[model samples]
Target: MKVGIAGLGTMGRVHAEAYRRMGANLVAVYDANPDRLAGFAAEFDVEAAASYELLLRQVDVVDVCTPTFTHLEMAETAFALGVDVILEKPLALTVEQGEQIIRAAREAGRRLFVAMVVRFFPQYRRAAELVRAGELGRVSVVRLKRVGFLPAAGWFRDPEKSGGMPVDLMIHDLDYARWLLGEPVSVMARRSPALSGQALEHVQALLAFPGGEMALVEGGWAYPPGYFRTGFDIAGDKGLIEWSSDQPEPLRTLFPKDEPPPALGLPMAGLEEDPYELELRHALAALESGGPFEVTPEDALAALKLALAVRESAASGRVVEVA
Candidate 1:
């Protein structure tokens, strides 16, 4: 399928390349930055849209690759013009804006899929599969740890643009937790800014759900060297599943084998050699499937709500019930 991409920043460039590798034609491209646009056009050998309006006309799906601030407005305009959309994460800066995007898509008879690419990662897919199969019966606990250095620009160091870790990074972990187990009933969290209040440098959160299920999430954009990690330790009645990217074998499961200890399952398959390529394949698969991509718009909103709930809980210093 032909897809148009907006923005030519890091993500936009990666996605454009992903489309090329996946055999999806990059029919149109847009970027307000002249330098970025020219570099992207040179690198991809694709048509440069004279204007955003012109780009949409040549593509069946519009990939919203712009920043968070521009996402809602762009998605609304794209869907209102009658093309399906692939929205980048944190769905929107606010729940109201997210709802409006959803409303616009529904009213226009269009599809909206969020690019929560973690769900496409093989480790996560295996974890979710194990959880669903009851081999890890009734998952009762999840632990996610992610800490890393920030992007050089507005990705984290600018609250006005990035919304700090709660939006830029933590939301991914939060969304994965909710997507894997279920939504939490309440969340308690602490948020702290670094040397400057320009952005948050640390966050700690505890999510509690019905049936005694729980998650402890720790993440930040301040770190030494460099760090980026995900997946969790999942505990259940029949078995325990462990996932970690740093390990050679990212997933291992234990089950009672009627022995002194237990039986261990094989290691998880390697993750996609390239994530952006996997995203392109999944997006096209969804287009062919007629609905329900790996990341649904409703799931995206639910994840954003949890992130905002963390902000609310931290600001108020009280447990915030998810709406």
Candidate 2:
């Protein structure tokens, strides 16, 4: 499949590398920053389109890896041009914009694949499978943690642009929690104030589902530089499941001294296959075969809704209903 990347940020670079690793036809890339555009073009050996429209014209699909605020504009443009869209997570800054993106895609008869890569992770996938197989009968409780350093990008520091830790960092587990359990009916949360100049934030959310299942999800950008961690604990009537990145295993992440903290999350330590590549491969195959995507547009919207509720609950110190 021919692919074009719409931004030269960290996530954009990661997607470009994943496409190359999968042997996809990476036609071109675009970025508003001239320096980043030029540098990324040279580094990837791909053409740099002067405008997003020009890049869209050259590929069958455009991967929108830009910031959260730009998602609506970029996705609408892709749909208008009859190109499939692979949008990065936190579908939009607001649920209204997310719904518009979905509406536009449907009207244009184009495929929209939200890049919720957590579902593609081997460990998470296996856990879901085990649950499906009745190994964890009547799962009742879940706890998830994703803590890391502040992202390197300036825009990420602005709550207006990145939606703070809830939408940017915690959305992964929020989505995963929903997938593992079910739709949450309400959410209660608390958060620390953003640190001066650092944009560091932390939040913990409690989600209640209609089936009496409960989840405690925590996310933060308050860790020391180069320190990142994630883990989960799941409990059910029949069994319990647990895993952590802190174990003396192959899943611990380390960053080089010269590199800045990653924009979204840390580059995972070691795995048999990269989850980003797995996600893209599935996207390509599903687009070609007209099969359903694992993470659909509605699923992305629902996740964003939950994350926004978390932010609201934290700010108000009240429980917010997942409407």
Candidate 3:
């Protein structure tokens, strides 16, 4: 498949590398910043499209790696041209825009894959698989944490652009929680005040699921520069599964004496391929085989709704009912 990347930023470069690794035809790339676009094109040996429109015309798929605010417009254009799209997370700044993108794709009859890379991470994928297979029978509680240093990009600090930390960062775990459990019935959240003249923020959200399942999801940009951490804890009637980035082991499981733990092979530390690359490969494979994407456009919209609810709950100091 011929692929063209939009937005020559960190994620844009990542997608380009993944496509190269997968041996896809990377025909073109575009960026608002000419210097970055030229540099990326030179580095990847791909054509630098004069504009997003030219890039759309050049490839079968357009990878929208631009900011959250730019997703809907770029996706709509690609869909209108009967080209598939791979959109980055938080699909859009608002649910309405996300729905519009979905509608455009439906009308265009093109595949719309949302890049929710968390779903591709080895440990997270294993946990979800085990939950679905009933290895973690009747799951009651899940705890997820994804905290890291503030992004160097100034746009990430702007609420209008990135939707703050909850919508931008926490949405990963929020989406994962929904994928593992189900749609959250309600969400209650708290966020640390953005310090004066500082962009750092933190949020902790409690999601109540329909079957009495609960998820404590937290994310932030309060860590020191270059610091990052993530982990998960899932508890159920039959067993418990845990994984932390700080731990030497990738995952740990405990089961009752009568119940044997499910067999799981861990990826070698520092040797596993990047989850972003895996996610892109899966998306392209689905596109080629006409299979379902791991993260559907509707799934992306649902995650956006939940993220918006988290923001609302944090601002209102009240539990927000998720529709």
Better of 1 and 2 by lDDT: 2
lDDT of 1 by residue, 2-119 (tens): 8899988878878888888778878879998877777787778888887777888888898888888888779888887888888778788888988999999999999988888777
Against the true structure, whose TM-score is highest? 3
| Better candidate by TM-score, 2 or 3 | 3
- Models sorted by lDDT, best on top: 3, 2, 1
Off by over 4 Å in 2: 249-271
Q: Across residues 1-323, which tens digit of lDDT does each residue of candidate 3 receive?
A: 89999988889888888888888889999999999999899999999999999899989998999998888889999988879999888889998898898998988898899999999988888788788888878999999999999999989989899988888998899999989888999999998988898878888999998888899999999999999999999999889999999998767888888865576444456437689889998998999999988788888889989999999998888999999
**Global lDDT of model 1:** 0.79
For model 1, the stretches where C-alpha displacement exceeds 4 angstroms are: 197-200, 256-270
Any runs in candidate 3 off by more than 4 Å, and if so which? 263-271
Cα shift from native, residue 285, model 3 (Å): 1.1
> How much is the lDDT of residue 26 in candidate 2?
90
**Residue-wise lDDT of candidate 2 within 1-323, one digit each (tens)?**
78899988888988999988989889899999999999999998999999999999999999999999899999999999999999999899999999999999999999999999999987677667666766656889999999999988888888899988899889999999999888999999999887777788899999999989999999999999899999987787766667687875433223344555333332344356899999999998999899999999999999999999999999999999998
